[model samples]
Structures are given as C-alpha cells and as structure tokens.
Target: MKRTAEKVLSVISLVFTVLSVIGSFIFVAIMKTFTEGTLRTEIEMELYADPELTVEDVDMILSVLEYFEGFSWFIVVVLVISLIATIIGMIFMWNEKNPKLAGIMFIVAGLFAFILSPTSIMLYIAAILCFTRKPPLAAEDQSFIDNQYDDSMRPL
Candidate 1:
C-alpha cells in the first residue's frame, strides 16, 4: 500500500512538474512579447500625448522603460531556473525515494509561477499535496513494525 501511495505521489509530482515548466516558458514568452510590443508602444504614446512634458521628462520616461525591459529579462531567466528545478524535482519523485522535500520545493516554485500567472495555481496545489501526503511503506517493509514484534511477546 505504501509503495502504491509512493508511486501515485510520484506520478502526481511528475505531471505537475512538467506543467509548471511548460507554463513558465509560455508565460515568460508572452510577457516578453507584450512588454516589448504593446506596452512599449503605449508608454511612448502616453509620453507623446503630453506636449508640456520636456525632453528631460521624455528621456527619464524612456530610461525607466528601458530599466523595466531589462528587469523583464531577469524574470525570464528566473522562469528558466524554475523550470530546471521542477524537472529535477520530477526526477526525484519518479525514483520513489525521499522526494518529499523535492516535491515541496517544486510546490513553492509553482506558487511563484502562479504569482506571475494564475494558470500555474493548479500545479502548485498538486505539488503541495504530493509533498505533504505520506506514502505508505511496502507491506513487507512495514509488517515487522506493524506487528509490534508479536502481540504475545508484550509484557502484560
């Protein structure tokens, strides 16, 4: 039963991990396109609409946008790193070892991804459950412990 539980948890973790990685990549790509395309155009238009705004103001605004663009790249890098972590966690879970910690790490990563995009919330919840639920040990492994070294041997 315990082995079965472990296998179940492993499958769950693997599924969620893959989801998180794919979601992260898609989110980062979409965000980058939006920021570079529509968002940049909007900012430029906003600056142009204000004729009273001096050249210094426009320069400052552009500078800010440039900084934002740079920061957005950092977010993409973070997403890549998160994808790697999720993959590692999936591998650990599939092995049916002490993957609880790995599962928890993946859950936290998924939560971070969720903050960036709500689509990742499902993966976050699934990974959390995978980490928290204790897997039952194999029957043979638990029999000795479960039997309590024979009830008859107990001191009355």
Candidate 2:
C-alpha cells in the first residue's frame, strides 16, 4: 500500500514538474507580449479615461512597466530554477530508493513553484502525503536490516 502511494506521489510530482516548466515558458511569453504590444495602449487608454489625468500620470505608469521589463529576466530565471528543481525531485521520487527525502524535496520545490506558478499545489499535497505516511518496510525485514547494521546505527 505504501509503495502504491509512493508511486502515485511520484507520478503526481512528475506531472507537476512538467506543468511548471510549461507554465514558466508561457508566463515568459505573455510577459514579453505585454511589454512589447498592447499593454502600453491599454494603460494609456485607462489613464486618459480619467478627465483629471495628466502627462505625469502616464509617465509614472509607463515607468513602472519599464521597471518591470527590466526585471522580467530575473523572473524568468527564478521560474527556470523552480522547473529544474521540480524535475530533479520527481526523478528521485520515481526511483523510490529514498522516497522520504525525495518527497520532501518535491514538496519544497512544489511550494516554490506554486508561489510563482499557482498550479503546483496538487503536486505539493501528494509529496506531503508521501513524506508523512509510513513506508511499506515490513517489521521482520526492518529487524533483519537492523541486526546487520547493529542497533546503535539503526534508524529510530
């Protein structure tokens, strides 16, 4: 049952990681379009719609967008890092050799992606469950391993 759960979690993580990469790519494209295309016109229309608006108001809004444009690459870098971390974590989980650690890494990576990507919450929950649940190691098998390693070196 635990192995089944771990497999499910690994699948979920893999899906989320792929989605994160796609989402990041989409975000970058959208941001590029916004900066280079109709966003300025939209902002100008909105500002001018108010009868009290002045040149300074338009300048302020354009300046803010310019500032955002300058930092857009930074956002891209962050999303790329998140995508890589999530993919690596999913691969580790799928191997199932160290699921607890892999699950933890996945959860952390998912959370990071979720904050910026908003679509990774599902993966984060699955990873959390995998980390919290007891693995399917049988008691007898655990005891055998314990004896081989000696009690002092055994995991509690």
Candidate 3:
C-alpha cells in the first residue's frame, strides 16, 4: 500500500539521483576534452604560422580556458548539489518522516535538475506524490483502534 509505494519511490529516486550525477560528470568530461582539443589545435596553428606567439595571445588563450573551466565547474557543482538534495529527500521519505519538508526539497531538486540534469521529470513526480499522500499510521495505533471497535461491537 502506501509503505510499498514509498519504498518503490525512494529506490527509484536513489537510482535516478546516482544516474544524474554520473551523467553530469560525463557531460563535463566530454565538453572539457572537446574544447581543450580544439584550443590546442588553434594554439598549434598560431604557433606554427607566427613562429613567435605574443604574450598577449597566450594570456588570451589562458583566459578563455579559465572562463570555460569555471563555467563547467559551476554546472557540475549545481547538478551535484541538486542530486544530493534529492537523495536526502528520498531518505526522509523512506523514513516516513517530515514529508512536507521532503516534498519541498524534492521540488527544489527537480527544478535544479530541470536546469542541468536528466532526472527532473522523475523528481517532480516524486515531489507530487510526497505532497499528496499522508504517512501510514503505526501498526500499534491501528491495532488499538481495531480493539476498541471490537469491544464496542461485542454484546453486553
């Protein structure tokens, strides 16, 4: 029932979060390798043609590399943070505790995922499920309620 659903949701969230993190790293690596290769080729061409590249030219190349590296790191950081938040939300949801807060965290994570990751849709669904459902009652509480009902129904 609700417990089974929660378990399934939490496991899916964990799986998706891990996949998103891995995908983010792969993306950054691919972009870095491609850009660096192109820059290297351009630098080699300039050096070959000029036979004496200027300091300013080197500085410009370095600046471009620095800018792109910074941008890539920023994207990675944001994606990682978002995935981490989703993981935390999954943990909270699994425990059946602080569901409202878990839902909010999942929403935030989903938004961040939308910006730069692939798990946005799944995370959004998880968030919605969290928000709409109430936690299942404890077994003891249910048993107590059942005993009270039985006592009332018995003959005097």
**Cα lDDT, all candidates:** 0.61, 0.64, 0.70
Task: Sort all candidates by TM-score, best to worst.
Answer: 3, 2, 1
lDDT of 3 by residue, 21-114 (tens): 6876886786576457776678656655674777677667667766776677776787777778887887777777777777888888877766
Candidate 3 ranges with C-alpha deviation above 4 Å? 1-10, 30-67, 115-118, 135-156
State how far residue 91 of model 2 sits from its true place (Å).
1.8
Off by over 4 Å in 1: 1-50, 111-116, 137-156
lDDT measured at residue 54 in model 3 versus the true structure, 0 to 100: 74
The alpha-carbon lDDT assigned to residue 151 of candidate 2 equals 58
Model 2, C-alpha of 2: deviation from truth (Å): 5.7
Off by over 4 Å in 2: 1-27, 33-52, 116-118, 139-156
Which pairs in model 3 have colliding backbones? none
TM-score of each: 0.53, 0.59, 0.60
Task: Give the winner by TM-score: 1 or 3.
Answer: 3
Q: Rank the candidates by lDDT, best first.
A: 3, 2, 1
Evaluate candidate 1 by giving its C-alpha RMSD to the native, one decimal. 7.1
Of the candidates numbered 2 and 3, which has the greater lDDT value?
Answer: 3
Tens digits of lDDT, candidate 1, 62-118? 776566657666666665655565666656666666567666766665654545454
Q: Among these predicted structures, which one has the highest lDDT?
A: 3
